[model samples]
Target: MDAAYVFAVRFRLDPDRGVAVEPETFETRLRRPADDPGESGWLFFRDNLWRGDLADAESFRGLTADALGVLVESVEYRALETDREYYDALREAIAADLAPFNADSVDEVVSKYLGSSVEIRR
Candidate 1:
């Protein structure tokens, strides 16, 4: 089994302005450790959106409509693994929990937030 990391990003807009700019979001999944391979979905998406990772400032000025109106407020992510060791560990954890808070399996927990853009690692 392999590891898959799911990234869910939320970009909040400036509050001082009179208008309410709707929050923007992007979700992507990737493999293992969340680092390396600078071209990974995580880095490519992150850099391109938040940083001026493009060839020139002209690209940025042109893309954001002359004013870089949006700025990133926060980012959050989750990691999932389905290897034998992880599976066995989750099984033990589920088995020894209280009924009200108990989960049928790791898949059950992961599925709750996996949504359509992503798949449960299993």
Candidate 2:
């Protein structure tokens, strides 16, 4: 089955300041793990919403823990594999999760919060 994976890292706001800034703070590039390709989904989505099932939740958790070391505090694992009919459902799930942020739409939210743009890797 063709599948997709989304992984994210969240940071607590600097308490001294009232504003929140989400930056990619944990460094995994130094770790010499041949298999680890550090991909972050939090910054990719303007809303930082996730909707999917994990193929192997425990294994994913372990990989994330190993990559981030002490900084990773919690993780949510999901599994989802959908054909044509369920695509809208997945989108709805994403929207519902993002409602709390009062975003007019995902694109607007992502553009504002994603910070630096990424180069697409084919």
Could you give candidate 2's per-residue lDDT for residues 1-122 as a string of tens digits? 12232344442223345665566344222211111112243222322323333334455556666765544544543222233333343345446566654668655443344322322222
Tens-digit lDDT track of model 1 for 1-122: 33344433334455675766454443333233433222245233233322212223344334433233455333334334345544454445444552533346545533433322233343
Q: Candidate 2: misplaced stretches above 4 Å?
A: 1-93
Q: Per-prediction TM-score, please?
A: 0.29, 0.25
Q: Which candidate has the highest TM-score of all?
A: 1
**CA lDDT scores, all candidates in order:** 0.37, 0.38
